[model samples]
Target: MTATIVVPTLGRPSLGRLLEALGPGLAKHRFELLIVDDRPGDRPPLALPPGIEATVLDGPARGPAAARNTGWRAARHEWIAFLDDDVLPDPDWADRLADDLAEAGEHVGGVQGVLRVPLPADRRPTDWERVTAGLADGAWITADMAYRRAALARCGGFDERLPRAFREDAELAFRVRREGWSLRRGRRRVTHPVRPEGRWVSVRTQRGNADDALLRHLYGPRWRQRLEIPPGRRHRHVAITAALVTAGAAALVAASGRRGWTAVAAGAGLAWAAGTAEFAAARIAPGPRDPSEVATMVATSAVIPPVATVHWLRGWLRRRAAEPLGSQPAGLPPAHRCPAGWAALSRPTASRSVPTRPFASRSAEGSR
Candidate 1:
């Protein structure tokens, strides 16, 4: 089965690195390449590897979900294999991609490639690295996954409304599964290197709290359970943040000089400080014990919860306003579209089983 390679890029220099490793083998495997540039109007050109036939297209700066929609919709082959630009494919990736779909039954609609993140073995990993490692265990993440063009078309491609990298894949997976097809896991290993990034990146990812709300809107409150995600501590974070804010406000009021307020402020300050220390210590305990690390953790832990809560609230409001009066609750197919008719509206239960095969077994004969 011939497949097309689609990578959505922001003109990252690492895109060149991925191609340097993946390009040479493309010719032998007869795979096609499409890179959707997500930069806004008038970006510079992408200089790809020589001797490779690649199509580079510009997208409406929406985000990875929209960019991917543009790429796969333009694919020439039936199978659209998506790899994030940050990931480096194995030398055998191209051939294995072909093998992934070579024998996919008609009932199977997608194949996920195994992702390996090589963390620092000699030292304790940073928080970001620990989080990145979790991608390998996700059910249908697009980090290194391929979907049949037909399956995508059936779902009207990805919901461009998602407009972000987070949960968009799961959103699509939900709809595709509802269409009565299976999504599988394949053993085509690709390394996702943890790029050096600012410490605040972990904090910045709190924006996904907003994305989680979007998932809840689309898939209902039980979305996390459907996806098998362990319950998050976001609610606890929210509570702690509320206490800290209340304590700070009390301290401010006490500065106006009431003795009773002074005692309350002192108690509140101690509670806030204790909570912050606990949060910071949990983060610090996982990694280096240096002062710089400790200070950074202390500062970020204080803000992450508030930031996450604000975003979640924003998403919640947005979803509530956008949804119509009488639609199916969240992730199920709409009444008109579902084969079960109005019955599907009762949150059609998910059948999560899918086949898994290691593409490594089939591609060994054809790979470098």
Candidate 2:
């Protein structure tokens, strides 16, 4: 089977390492390579190996979803395999990928590659490292996923409106299954290493709450249930944010000499403190808990709730009247309808089952 490898990049230094890691696959496989650059303006040329050819296209810089759409749409083969620029594919990736494609039944529209994240052996991982490691148990993440060209075209590719890598892949998977195509877990494996980032990375990640809100708009409030995604901390964030807002409001009222406002302010302030402390402890508990890590956790824990709640509200208000991308499929249910050829795909064999551990769905911006 012929394939095209599509990688969306932001011109990070990891791009070079990723290309080098693909050498073994390129040497043995006949698939084409397409690199979609999501950066703007003049960029340095990529160093290529001898006897290898690749196509580099300019991306819209919208996000990984848009960039991936650009890559697969321009692909020359029936199968388009997506890989993050930071992941290292196993040396036998090409062979395993080919086997996987060959094994895909006629009704199978997509295949997900297994992801393995390497964490520190001697010490507990930091919060960012733990977040990055979530890809290992994530289902249908574009970190290492492939789709048949026909399936992608039928689903209209990814929802570019997502504006980020978050949830877009899983959303597409649902749409594909809703269209009567089955998705399978492939044997190919990729290693996702944790990339270093600033101390405030957790605060930055709270922005995904906005994407979650948009998803809720598109798929309805039960989107998480329909998509089989576990619940997030959105509820807690909302409550914490409410406490903070109440504290500030009541404090202002007390400063204005309102008699009962002082009690309200004190109560709200204590609630906020308690919520923040719990959040910080939860994060710091499983971590290495060094002085710096603890301090970062405490600071970001205090800041994340309000930021997340703001993003969530902004997303909801922005897409308040937006319609779903399309009509829902009519049958047993939208996402659970198994067509003729999907019985086996739905209940994967023991060897094929995706990992059962809880995982965070994320992107390069925050380790998705």
Candidate 3:
């Protein structure tokens, strides 16, 4: 069974490094590589190896979901393997993937590979990068995931509505499982090195909260809880910020002869400080860098929760408005049982006879 490796790139120069790492594996597996350029202006920097077919597709700057859909659709192979432009595959990745697919019968719908990111030794990560880095080794079912072409066609690929590169994979995985297909972990793995990120990485990543809200809309409130995933702290932060703002405004009003407003403002400040301290302490590591970074993290953390909450709430509201009022929810119920005779039946057993009652009962009744 031939496999096509589909890579969606955003014009990162580091993609050349990813390609170089795949050199040995690609040659051994002889899988076709399809690179979808999400950035229209830039082309892939590296040359394709001999006998390895490569294609580039151009279109408007839609996100990775669209690019992946386009690339997977273009592929002629039965299996389509997706790799992030930033990831470096292990040497036996291809062979292991082939073996994995072989072991996974037709019922298996998708395969996810492990992702590892190595951090730098000298510098402490910014609050935002740390949050993003939390995802590095996180059962990342996105990068290095493979799916059957038929499964993609059935589920209609990733939702184009997911504008960013976040939660799109979860949405797809959820849908595939909902359709009675299974997603298994693959033996193959990839190392995702942490690229140098800007100071605003955390701030920029807040947009993910909005996408997450979309996921909640698509799935339900219980999605995170049931999946054993924690809700992003953004909502809690937002709530605290709202309280602080309200109190501060009330205090200013009270200072102008309104005693109630002043009390409210004072309460608000105390609450904010307490909340900040708690959040900082939880995230703080045990080192000299801990206190400073924790402070920065706390200061920035307050901002994120509210911004994320508002954006998520906006997406949720918009989705609710657009959806038809009484549309049926997606997927089958969790506890659906097979029909009676459909299940394999056990051999019929002989009935055990009950012991006879004593005759003394009738004689006693007659005497009464």
Candidate 4:
């Protein structure tokens, strides 16, 4: 199978590591490499081994989703293998990818490569490390997934509006499976190293709350259940934020000698503190008990709920204003219904009907 390897880079230092690991594969295979520079400006100068054919293109910098879309659209081969700049491919990646694609049938539209995150075994992982390790269990992440070019065309690639790497992959996969195509897990495995990040990385990730609104706008509120992800405590976070805010306001009113407000404040304050303490304990228990670590956790725990709540609310309100419920985004294909036998997905009524033009046909037209 002729394949093009597409990688999206944000000018990461790890890009060099990934390229060095793929040197052998590049030497042995006639694969084309499409390196999309998501950073704004002129084309980037990426060095590679002799005799390798590679092209670099500028990405919209909307996000990784958009970058991958640019990379795959510019690809020439029938199969597109997407690798993130930070991932390390196995030495036999070429052979394994060939083997994975060789076995795909007409019904198989994509093959997801295995992702292995190597965590330090000596000590209990930090909250950030544990969160990063979740990628190992994450399905269909482009970190090492390969797609049939036709499948990508059918799915209209990915939703470029999802301006983050989070949930965008799942959103695309959710759409693809609706087209009556199956995505199989492939044998190829890549190592996704956990690079050091700031203590507040977890807090910053709440930004995906806005992206979640897009997913709900496209799929509906039951989207998580559709994807089989466990129900998150976002509502509880909102409740916690509300309780804390209400408590503070009531405490101020009570200071004005309002006895009724004093009672309300006391109850709200207890609930808020309880919620915060529970959150802090969960994070603190698994983390290294250093002073900075403890302080960071304490500070972030108080802040995350309100911040996450605000982002979620902003995303929800933004969607409600921009599009009504049950309406699909303009220029985008409607979500495809899962084929019968997917008992779990059978309930999303919106996805039950196929779009007017076949997803592949519409996608091809869109590309032109």
Give the CA lDDT, 0 to 100, for residue 11 in model 4.
71
lDDT of 3: 0.65
Tens-place lDDT per residue, model 4, 285-357, is 9877678888988989989999999998888787765532222334433223322233222222221221121
User: What local lDDT does model 1 show for residue 365?
Assistant: 21
Model 1 agreement with the true structure over 1-368: per-residue lDDT tens digits: 67889888887777878887887678788788887767777645564545556767667678888788778766677678998999998988777777788867767789999899888888787777778888877778898889876667656667666777777887777777776678888868899988788879878888888878877776677988775565787777777777777777887888887567767767776776777777778888988667777777888988887788888998888877554123234676432244322321232221222122222222212110
Candidate 3 pairs with clashing backbones: 234-305, 238-306, 254-258
In model 2, pairs of residues that clash are: 362-368, 363-368
Comparing 1 and 2 on lDDT, the stronger one: 2
Per-residue alpha-carbon lDDT of model 3 for 165-278, expressed as tens digits? 877777777766665667888788788777776644666777777777766775677877543355667656776777777777887798789656777787888887777666
**All candidates: CA RMSD (Å):** 9.0, 9.1, 21.1, 8.9
Model 2 scores worst on lDDT over the 10 consecutive residues at: 353-362
lDDT of 2 by residue, 1-368 (tens): 88999988887767767777777777678788888777756655443333345777777778998888888877777789999998988888889999999999878889999999999999999999999998899889999999887676655678877887688888888888877788999999999989889999888877788888888988887999877677888889889999999999999999999899999999999999999999999999999999999999999999999999999999888878876565333343333333423332332122121122111221223211
User: Which window of 10 residues has the lowest lDDT sum in candidate 4?
Assistant: 359-368
Misplaced by over 4 Å in model 4 are 41-51, 321-368
Better of 3 and 4 by lDDT: 4
Point out the worst 10-residue segment of candidate 3 by lDDT: 359-368
Off by over 4 Å in 2: 47-51, 327-368
| Each prediction's TM-score versus the true structure | 0.83, 0.87, 0.79, 0.84
Alpha-carbon local distance difference test for all models: 0.73, 0.80, 0.65, 0.75
